[model samples]
Target: MTVSAPPAPPAAQRTPPAPAAPRRRRPIAPYLMVAPLVLVLAGVLLVPLVRLIVVSFQKYGLDQLVGGRPSEWVGLDNYGEVLAAEEFWSSLWHTVRFLVIAVGLTIGLGLLLAHLLAKVSRSVRVIMLLAMVMVWAMPPIIAMPMWRWLIDQRFGVLNYTLFHAGVLPTRSFNWFSSPVTGWTVICAIVVWGALPFVVISLHAALTAVPGELVEAARLDGAGAWRVFTAVTFPAIKPTVLIITVLSIIWDYRVFAQIWLLRDIGANKDTYYTIGIWSYVESFSNKNFGLGAAISLISVVLLGAFSIFAVRSVLRTAQAADAEADAR
Candidate 1:
């Protein structure tokens, strides 16, 4: 009788869980919001880039394009022709030189300006920022002509003023006559044109530095210079690298300054960047294939730089994650 009672008590049933209501999918509202931007980018940027890449491999001449002969594929022959040409190599070297000088000048001056402006009062900082913006907003063409005029030999205001002040030996110092002098002047103009953007970007980055972090460094016995080198430098380094890379790219493709100077009777041979060489190949020599090849080489060089940039970003991200984990 006791065994039968225990067995009856052990037969209690377990309840099953209630089925979960099917999760309503999240509304696609955010993606829909970005659709306009996606469309704009595809239309304005991506389509053009794809077209350019396709046209680059084709043997299309100005005449062929106009007459509608239809461009035929030429494979790597165009690239071989570009590589075999002396002018292409020389132009590439010139571009490399310009990039080195321009990037150095831009980053060095920009960092100095950013550091100085970062320490200024709020109102003064705003004024400085506005001034930088004004320069940045001005077109390159505007500044190019002005620089050309200022450096002109005969009937130039800068030379006239210098001669009146007895600073220069003669009233007509040829600024763009000599190849060496012309290149120097062109590089100076390019650096000046690029400086404002560098200054503003780095200034913004510097201003974003955390005061608490800076104070902590000071508490740990770091001096102004030490704190800047150790803390501020590290914090703004990513922005600095980004700006430097952009400057490198811009400087590498500099054509207007060189062209303007050349038009002003300066030696076109003074500074022939890859851009100028490509232009000459296409329009001057009517060799579209060689021009396309030169452009592709330029693309490869820039691509290499981009690869380096990506690696740098990835390394920095990994280091940051490691540091966070350690903390």
Candidate 2:
């Protein structure tokens, strides 16, 4: 039996090892597809932004823009002039004041509207949503004139109504005579225009909140405000923070409303913000260099604010994630 075993096959006669499957090269199809969009953005946005930064340091004017002459390099002289001017400081202060008031009112009103919309019936909600969308869709140009007419000194319906209702001592109270009254009108207009978008965002965020959590809080004897603070606000805090930052940005750059309403009073210069100042410096005064410097300063300030807000939001998100994981 030991000698009966067949001799082993030779190595050369054995089956060849199976050839390795060909390795696939990494696919670059995605990059190839997105290349067109990247090119368009570089041409449209990046190029112009770089040119703007370059022009900010040069004494470029309508002549240079129209190819009449080469721009003179002024280095930081334009920035120095802008910083030295009292007008720049005044405009900056006005801008800051307007931003604080408008942003506060817009956010507070938007949150209230969102809460109301969330508690409404579907049909009512649809109607309110449509109204908000309509308001949001209106152009600033149209809104400015409409508001102006409504607050007009002689023919305004507001004065007439208030006088007839005995809320005013006179039928023709000059609303724009004082700086306080003028700014109040401007802030009101900005807040009104900005409300719809904020409301829509906040409503969507509120809808995403868990109903069961709210119900549990209520069952534990929590009131409406308490339930919102305890069970709902934590969920929507990130969204609120984002909307607030956006509102700040939008309100900070408000120009049309203030500009259009400027001619209503003799002391309208009191209402001038950075936007108006930039326009005046660039177009009216024809000091393009100083104007660009002012604009750059504004951009830098806004960028700083945005960076701070982003860091705060990231911290909040990380904290939320940690808390979630712990649970």
Per lDDT, the best of the predicted structures is 2
Minimal lDDT window, size 10, model 1: 3-12
Candidate 2 regions exceeding 4 Å error are 1-26, 62-67
Model 1, 1-327: lDDT tens per residue? 455434443335745679999999988999999999999999998887776667678787877767878788988778877888788778777878778877898899889988888778989989988887887888888887787678778878889998999997898898766766677778888887888889988888987888899999999999999999989888777788778778887887788878877766556765678889888888888777667777777888888988998788778757756765786
Per-residue lDDT for 314 in model 1?
71
> Cα-based RMSD of the predictions, in order?
4.2, 5.4
List the global CA lDDT of all models: 0.81, 0.89
Could you tell me the C-alpha RMSD of candidate 2 in Å? 5.4
Per-residue lDDT tens digits for candidate 2, residues 125-146, read: 9999999999999999999889
Global CA lDDT computed for model 1:
0.81
